[model samples]
Target: MNTDTARAAILAQIRARQGRPAAQHAMEVADVEVDIGRHVRGPQPALGDRADRIARFTAQAQALQTRVARVASAQDVPAAVAAYLHEQALPLNGVAWDTLAAHPWAEAGLTLEYRPPRDEDKLGLTGCFCAVAETGSLVLASSPATPSSTHLLPETHIAIVPASRIVPALEDAYALLRAELGELPRALSTVSGPSRTGDIEQTIVLGAHGPYRVHVVIVDAD
Candidate 1:
């Protein structure tokens, strides 16, 4: 069936299951909205101060085998990324999200294409939608400017996160998303570290599916 027909069928099934008349549909939707607005989160452990949050995030990230770095501001992001690439002996060429195209990449002596990463691309840079300090995960939302390929196809992935955007818990990340976007994006990708699996012989191997190396650059939002 066509997209509209499929959607109509799904809605019809849902309405039928609800057993509410057509006249109550509006009221049901309104009630759902109210419940969403009044959503009470479950109890969570206190994460202490902001400094503690940063420390916890760094610790968790490192424990997950992810390298983390801190920069004073956005202007320092290029230099930080460059330094990481140089330290790792990787090429200074890669694809990056358009949101970061305005940065001074040339000043850092790097070549970054502001587009989606191609199959041959080995490095990619992206700005995250938010981060979870509790789990040290970078939350990425796919959009026209920020494609999923930038984080998935590359062998080396570099993410720039604003310190202020780091929430205390994973739930807080979703709350921030809802408050800002009013709706979820087409794709929400969360990367705690480089991809790995031990399904074979119970031996760990990184980059089995995605990037072999995941580096994070935390920029001071202030």
Candidate 2:
């Protein structure tokens, strides 16, 4: 069954257990819309101006061991990514989101498969829906064209972020999502630096559950 259908069924079961009839789908949807419209935001930290936010994001990301790079325009992304890979002595083979297929990867001498990542794929490339400056996290909305596996399954993940898409806080990211997407996608992922786990003897180990390295290439002009 589809996600919506499965969700409705689960809710129906819960209602039945509570000795109440299942609510109409339309009514439920309308109620959710109203609640969202009336939602109140909690107080947030000051993020200064746009330039300040970008600087803060860069600092925070660096602290988390995420490499950040700035490019003048979208056309410069390939070269920046290529440079990073070369510096790290990594292979130039990878997978990328289908939406990013138009970028000149070939010209940069990078071989990228425009599909979901495989077990052996060492690198993955993607674009963020928006970036949260407060936490230095990238917000990724999953769809058919932009699979989450592209970031999750690879050893290295390179994200191309548009400078204009960076937001002050996590709340702003969600607000932008609601304003633009109207509804949530299949999955929403927020990544901050490389995935690490200190579960074994409290020693941090990167790539425990995801990419060992997270690289951000910020494009000044989208």
Candidate 3:
């Protein structure tokens, strides 16, 4: 089932448990919709001018051990990604979102499979729906073309984010989603950095659950 259908079913079950009949449940749903339409927002931090958003996001991402790179445009993404992989001595073969299949990846000497990553694949590349400058998180809305596995299954995850898509905070990212999509995607993922765990001897262990490295390529549209 789709996200909206699943959400509706879950809410309906809750309403049923509350002893509300179908009609009353419909009314409650309507009320919730009305509130959602209002797009109420809470207090937000004072993020500086819009131009500084990239800088703030970069700093926060770096603090989380996520390497960041700046590209002039989408056309430069493949080159930048290639350069990063070479610098880190990583393989160039991996899976990528089908939506980016149009890019000149082959020209850049990169071999990216336009599908989900396999066991042998160590890298995954994807695009973000939006990015939170406050926490330096990449917000990904999953679809058939962009599966969640692309961001999780690989040992290394690389994201291509457009600078214009950066928002001040997590709330702003959600607001933008509500404005653009009436309903949420089946899977919405917010990744701040590579996976790590401090369960062993209180020492942080990278790649405990997911990718060990996360490289972000921020494309400046203008």
Top candidate on lDDT is 2
Q: Which digits, one per residue and each the tens of the lDDT, describe model 2 over residues 103-216?
A: 999999999989898788999999999999988999999999999999999999999999899999998998899999998889999999999999999999999999999999
lDDT (0-100) at residue 78 of candidate 2?
98
Q: State the TM-score for model 2.
A: 0.85
Ranked by lDDT, the better of candidates 1 and 2 is 2
Better of 2 and 3 by lDDT: 2
Report the lDDT tens digits of candidate 1 across residue range 1-222.
999988878887787788955344677889989998886788886898778888888888989898999998899989999999999999999999999999999999999899888889999999999888888899999999999989999999999988888889988998898999988999999998999999999999999989999999998765
Candidate 1 residues lying further than 4 Å off, grouped into runs, are: 1-38
Give the best candidate by TM-score: 2
Ranking by TM-score: 2, 1, 3
lDDT of candidate 2? 0.93
Model 1, residue 84: distance off in Å is 0.7
TM-score of each: 0.84, 0.85, 0.83
